[model samples]
Target: MSPLPRFGRIADGPPAPAGGGESFATLLAAGGARVERIASLAQADPPGAWYDQPGDEFVLLLQGAARLGFAGGEERALAPGDWVVIPAGCRHRVAWTDPARETLWLAVHLPPIAGRGAIADQ
Candidate 1:
């Protein structure tokens, strides 16, 4: 026997939050990897806060703009079609997001592979 197929569009999913909020919806989870659709509006990490995850995260900006800040003081700006890879245990935060528009993101979380230093693109 074989697994069945699944299909859906990112645009036809849930709407982003209104009045400055955020939402995360899981699209798929299998073999220790998870994919999600994140929607945000005028949202960011609080001051002096950072995210230290157990797995690597690959994030793609589908709509609007955002800025990511690292613990080492580096920052990266993202626009539509931009993407980034954040490794496990890397302290980072969402520094800024477009205040006037809804920002949609696709995030894939990958568990660390044994004997691998960096998470390669899949």
Candidate 2:
């Protein structure tokens, strides 16, 4: 197997909505793995943006704290160094973030599960 490459710098990604108070940077993308950097708000508030994708996602908090809102009314608070796994196609949004500090998140998008139905199912 090839050795993993080292990441020295983070690249800027798509711009978040105005007043949304969020930002992201893509770090890596390989055959079945991807890594990104995300920043956002610090308090529970609705009207935030949601993200859903065909592949599963894993997030590791690098700085600050925030809460994740799921489609099923489930909410999870995460702090720096915390990690979370989100199954493919699970509708989710940010519920809160540290207002004083920008929440930095390391997100990894993995390949979709094989033989699994579309993400809309579960």
Candidate 3:
């Protein structure tokens, strides 16, 4: 069998199904860490819902726009090139994403308990 291609484009994934929120594909996973390519099309977290993930997430906005909400009522708007480091166990949600076009994101997820310190050490 041929080896997996080492180079790929973030926009190569298929779009989300109609009204199907976001789409994600694992690009790489190794040593307790995984990288993913996420695509959003006018998606937002349901009202009052929050994602309390077990692993930390580092996300980079590649195209379009988005808004993120935190548990303490803090919010941030992201544009192309903007990135955020969300600590594990942090309550957060995607408040909004542009509906006019597909929004792309590059996300990195690390194992539980291997949070901020692991990031700093790398």
Q: Which candidate leads in TM-score? A: 1
C-alpha lDDT (0 to 100) for residue 78 of candidate 3: 98
Which portions of model 1 miss their true places by more than 4 Å?
Answer: 114-122
Model 3 earns a TM-score of: 0.85
lDDT, residue 56, model 2: 80
Query: In candidate 3, residue 52 scores what lDDT?
Result: 86
Candidate 2: count the clashes: 5
- How does candidate 1 fare on TM-score? 0.88
Question: For model 1, what is the alpha-carbon lDDT of residue 109?
Answer: 93
Show how many residue pairs clash in every candidate, following the order shown: 0, 5, 0
TM-score of candidate 2 to 2 decimals:
0.72
Rate residue 50 of model 3 by lDDT: 100
lDDT of 2 by residue, 81-109 (tens): 89987888788988888777667778888
| Residue 51 local lDDT, model 3 | 92
Write one digit per residue (lDDT tens) for candidate 1, span 1-122: 99899899987767667877678889999899999998888888897899988789999999999999999899899999999999888899989888899889999999877776566667
The model with the greatest lDDT is 1
